[model samples]
Target: MAKGKDVRVRVILECTSCVRNNVNKKSTGISRYITQKNRHNTSSRLELKKFCPYCHRHTIHREIKK
Candidate 1:
């Protein structure tokens, strides 16, 4: 018989404004909100580099990687 406990998770949200220059603040805000909601099942944290077509810049976003 094997027994184990459930593992908790966490998520980190970042901005993706390093490409163009439109107005990704709203998008970033939304992303953060979403991440917050799913910050209870993340196994590993992975930083993702996303280039916003509207911002035309290289930004960062974190997520679970396992």
Candidate 2:
């Protein structure tokens, strides 16, 4: 076993609803969360269920490119 170059990488999670509902004026400036993931243990993109202040509900937050 060995550690990869990107052992820990910074990632951003954005609200799925906010991105889809762009027409909504309130959806402006989508909510996002910053986090770090283990590249070796979990190389795949991470999707987390988090609360969105604008949406005011738990939404699927998917990892996005920096």
Task: Tell me the whole-model lDDT of each prediction, alpha carbons only.
Answer: 0.43, 0.88
Global CA lDDT of candidate 1, please? 0.43
Q: Compared to the true structure, candidate 2 yields what TM-score?
A: 0.84
Question: How would you encode candidate 1's per-residue C-alpha lDDT over 1-66 as one tens digit per residue?
Answer: 332343433455544342122254334232321243333454456566765443455567555333
C-alpha positional error of residue 24 in candidate 2 after TM-score superposition, expressed in Å: 4.0
Ten-residue stretch with the least lDDT total in model 1:
28-37
Q: TM-scores for all candidates?
A: 0.30, 0.84
lDDT comparing candidate 2 with the true structure: 0.88
Error of 1 at 7 (Å): 15
How far is 36's C-alpha from truth in model 2 (Å)? 0.5
Model 2 segments beyond 4 Å from truth? 1-4
CA RMSD, predictions in order: 8.3, 3.4
Candidate achieving the largest TM-score: 2
Q: List the residue pairs that clash in candidate 2.
A: none
Each prediction's total of clashing residue pairs, residues at least 3 apart in sequence or on different chains, is: 11, 0
